[model samples]
Target: MKAVCTVLIACVTMFLVPTAVAQDARRITPEQIDRLVKPYLDAKRINAISIGVIDGDVSLTHHLGTLSRDIPNPPTDQTIYEIGSISKVFTSLLLASEIEAGNLKLTSTVGELLPDVSKANPALNSVQLVQLATHTSGLPRMPANLDLSNVTDPYATYSRESLHTYLSSIDPAAKPGEKSEYSNLAVGLLGDVLAMRSGDDYDVLIRRVIAEPLGMTDTGAMLDPSCLSDSQKSRLAPPHDANLDANYNWHFASLAGAGSVFSTTSDMLRFAAASLDPPDNDLGKAMRLSQQKHAAPIGSGVAMGLGWHFARDKQTLWHNGQTGGYHTMLMVNPKLNAAVVVLCNTAMGDVDALAGQFIQTIAGMNVEPKSFDEALTVPAETVARLAGQYEIAPGAVLTVRADQSQLFAQLTGQPEVQIFAISETKWKYRVVEATIEFELPDSGPASSLTLFQSGMKVPGKRK
Candidate 1:
């Protein structure tokens, strides 16, 4: 109901208090952060957020607001928020570790691990594992064979049979090395290949190699109720749209390299710190290489490293995540030995601006992020008329509700939050880190709405 899009403030505004033991601690002051973020959070109508920062060996955790808009659960360092595609970084590390150990090869073909894959499409057998992991393997966001009947759980319905059928008919839209396109299917398949090559399940491989060694007990693909301590499990807040009933779930598939892992701020801090400072393990150098720039001239002004994404001109290596009702951003700057983790419980609230603002403050750079009101605009009449629910498709419906003179969008099986009007016809929602815009195609569709995200847009007929 409130401003759903929050802006980022400067560091001095975030930390107003002269930090204690300022001479020793190189951390940003809490007062300065509060001065900067609190008002922004209020203005954006964010329900709950857990932020973590790492500088050298010292890490700072900050929690503000409640976990749920309805229940108001307080967030803490241990709060487990689904770090969306950030899971790819972990999966990438796993692949890198295996490659470093000679258990797997980046150039290995998927057919080597899954024999049936070659039988489906001989051409696909030549696609190297690295290309799949880097999303340059020419796979689409998802398999064309998938049926969207299970909208509530997209991946849960994609079984092995469906994957095989899709691969058997694989016809790449482009040459493998021609361009860089983000493919959830490609990376997801990479995870499965790594697991098969190592003769270990995704869950087991991660724990045996990465999680257990780093003391990241709370992070994993699936949480066992019997294994997790009450306190540890309690740290998980109810994510956006209590209707979803649980944190986002990733169905096991060959495409595991894309996104599947779940973790908390505390666990991520440990992971980020290890990434910045390689421990006495084979993965240390491998991860460093993974975070380095490996591809270029791609979308996001950067290219894929081993499994990580690197900025074009900066030492900042980062990845963002979006699942059903969760959005996450994790970044680390090798030059600064500084890492940041931004986790949110709500799906539709914009936190990217907050992340940028926080980074500027921590880096002592001055920048002003646009606020929600300034970030969005729409005609008063259209804003008023578009305040009701509309069916985007036959079985898929989205509700656009007006709250506090602001517009919010709610898709079935998702969390509800105010939407930011980025333009006259475009609305951006954070739940899936995507944008939806309406358009009237002059030649064909007189009245149609289009959804856009990550440079890809699809038209949806208004129902």
Candidate 2:
């Protein structure tokens, strides 16, 4: 009975509002921000919220909710949140900085870095470092050999040996630079490669070269176990589950570049600000270049930057992350000196979407991008006609149905999802971030539906 929606429909219909209208460059008023953000924070069992709204040279910061519901500890702008994959942008930038320093080259192969790189297997000795970083190396989401017993503590046991063995048998999904498929193993491996090449620790290199230079005091892989005082630990927000149980923590150190960076809203906002400005340090410019598109286009009007998702209409750059209990979002609107960073301690739904709505409101755009509900149409019979199993890719089947007044879909391997009818023909779902549109074909079939998400679309033939 529990379902996750596959696509987020807002980005497609949402248009940007010009921020040219000059307003006072003060922090966003609490009243103005509360009006826009209070709904989600209040409705969801959010543990804590830290939001930084930067406009012009001024930034308004808010610390809402509590670090723990049982205890009454309020969060401050200084409270750190584990910024997941956004760390990838930083790692990629480190690689770029190495490039600028003539210490590394983007074109260098992994084999070149570790010529004797046969840890768990032999074939891995030849993989390229760039391939792993950009995720064009045909790696899975994680190591193929990893059989995590505890889903919550999944990566706790993934070892370097096992990773090397998987790489030895690695069969690329796409060639070295064919397509963009996100791979934690790939990016993490790139981190190892960087460390191997530099003869310095990955964490130390990132800190000494990037974080310290940018004055991002709270941005790093792990907080000193000693630094977290008993009060601080007690004040730390625990991640939430649907049943309100305690969840697990994410491991980025073992898998370094993939997803392991912890940071606070203030630090992230500073990172975004520095990212928008040209790199004053060698690492900064390299970071910008890493976010620049490298391979063929993957999503609609979007391309894969070195490690981030590149979207254009107004050249908006964004990346979001979801670990077990946390959701993080960071976006930079370079055109406007404006950017939004939201960190929430909850596994509830699309926190990024919620945060983006607030950002949209702050930018004077229509905050509530509209979508359909199940009962909006009375013709379930017609919607049923559009229901059935659709095969979009090899070994992938998307099942659709019309129940009562709603149209629903479930990928063959996924649970059933109720699709919101955006229009009679177009439907949008959840964080999977795709769209399902029904169309009438003139000659082939009576009515057909096409699947569009990110940038890929496949039409369903009548079956």
- TM-scores of all predicted structures: 0.77, 0.75
lDDT of 1 at 114: 69
Instruction: Give the alpha-carbon lDDT of every model.
Output: 0.62, 0.62
User: For candidate 2, what is the TM-score?
Assistant: 0.75
TM-score of model 1 relative to the true fold? 0.77
Candidate 1, poorest ten consecutive residues by summed lDDT? 3-12
* Residue-by-residue lDDT tens digits, candidate 2, 1-463: 0101112221222235454645542235567666666665554445677788777677777777776656567678777666666677777777778888888777877666655554543445545666676667666556656654455645546666666666766666656565555666777778767765677756677777778988887766632334344544544457654223466565644576666677777788778888778666676678777767666555433455666655444455666665556667777766666777888766444556656665566566645533323324636656666777767666557778878768777654333545666666677654335678886444332266788854557777555
